[model samples]
Target: MSSVSTRASFTAPALALVINAFVWGTSWWPFRQLEARGLHPLWATVLIYAVAVLVILALRPRALGQLLRTPVLWILVLASGTTNAAFNWAVTLGDVVRVVLLFYLMPLWAVLLARLVLREPLTHHAAARVLLALAGAAVVLWPAGRSGWEALPLPRTLPDWLGVLGGFCFALNNVMLRREAHRPEEARALAMFVGGMAVAGTLALVLVGNGMASPPPAPAPGWVAGVAAMALLFLAGNLALQYGAARLPANVTSVVMLTEILFASISALALGGGHLDGQLLGGGALILAAALLSTLSGADAH
Candidate 1:
């Protein structure tokens, strides 16, 4: 009975994690398609998030009032918004493997920011995990680095930089979320979703207004079908994340979410859409190991 109960305990979150990973992993392909069809990824984000926001509003109009009443929630909005927008935009613009790996650097960010934001003490185990994760990031993005002062002890590629920055921001975002964990989970999820839309929309406006990118063109005939699918997936993914996040420790959740990198990397490789070189492979192992350690370490803490 104990064995059976132990197995059952892991079932739901495992399934949710897998589904979320698959959604995020394959998201890049459709985003690229939309880009090819003249719909910028930012605009694509806007479309999906708009649907999510509307759904949330329809279900809970009071959430809006709740959001407005809390300044801390606004801070949450900014953090989550930057995380989602920067991560999405960066992945679409960079190497899938690099972007995903860099984003997983959240463990490092979470540890440091946890100390500052949540007043959580940094255990030796957590500190070790942070260093391991950072080493892995450096290995993965090694190909992007160059010579002289230009070489800042990291990858030399522009996409690699974008991915690293995205990961750092992601870490900060999650730390902030955990700091505000006392808030209602539903409210947090709503803020994250709405914040994602606001951030993406604002960036899009700036980029277009500044003539950095062209305006979003009318999508092809089948665009609506794709958009619908994406919207449903986004809503489902967000819901799963919100639910799982509320139930689990942030460290554990971060580890579970690392499954997204595996899902994306394997799919990309299988589809001949991406490559796995030595640095990326080695770096990925380190990152995975670190995340797993972090999760397992936190398992008994709560």
Candidate 2:
């Protein structure tokens, strides 16, 4: 009986983490679907997060006050908002697998951000992990039949740039969360949700003014349903992440979250949003290896 109880406790949180991973992994599909209906991803991000923010406010009305009191939380808001906006737009326009791989370069950015923001030491292990992840990124970026300078490991397209930007912001977001971990959890959550709405909403307006992007289309049942469902899904995923991460070791949480890559890859391929080749496979392995190593290093530090 004791053994069974212990097993259940561990399994439940792990499963919750998986649920979070699955939501993000397959999120590209719904985003693409909304885009097809003439809803720009930036606008979609605004609506989805707006609903999520309302839900959070309803449940934790005081969270907004706490979030506003801490000025640093505003940085968290900006980082989290850019992370979502860039990622959602990138996945909608670019090859899903490539964009996701680039975004997973979070470990590379995390090392640098931690040093800068948290004043954490740049340990030898962290440096090596950064190099490994960079190497992987080079592999992914090297154009076929190109060599030397022509094969520069640079982002080649809008989506590629967005992917890298999102990853950088994501690393910063994580660092801020760690730096401010002493704050109330609800306040942190509220900050992130509000950031999503504020940043995306502002960007959408700017783009619409410039005619670079279209305004949200008139109300339709199909898109209305899609946006609502996506909002619920994101909210659920966030809750699951909080639950699982609280109960599990940091290393375990990191490893489980990496499954988002697998889910994204498979869904993209199946849905005709991405393709695979030798270069992508090899590069992805190196990136994931670096991420895994970073998780282990984090565990050691703890």
lDDT of 1 by residue, 1-302 (tens): 99988677666766776688789988888887777777788888878888888898899888887887777888778777777777777767877876788777767776777778777888988888888998887677564547666555575665666666666766666666656768766677688788888988999999999998777676567666677789999889877775676566656776777779888888777765578898788988898887788677772121
In model 2, the worst 10-residue window by lDDT is 293-302
What ranges in model 2 sit over 4 Å off?
146-149, 299-302
TM-score of each: 0.89, 0.97
Error of 1 at 300 (Å): 13
- Angstrom error of the Cα, residue 211, model 1: value is 1.7
Spell out the clash pairs found in candidate 2. none
Stretches of model 1 off by over 4 angstroms after superposition = 1-6, 143-146, 155-158, 243-254, 299-302
Question: What tens-digit string does per-residue lDDT give for candidate 2 at 36-102?
Answer: 9999999999999999989889999999899878999999999999999999999999999999999
**Which prediction has the highest lDDT against the true structure?**
2
lDDT at 71, model 2: 95
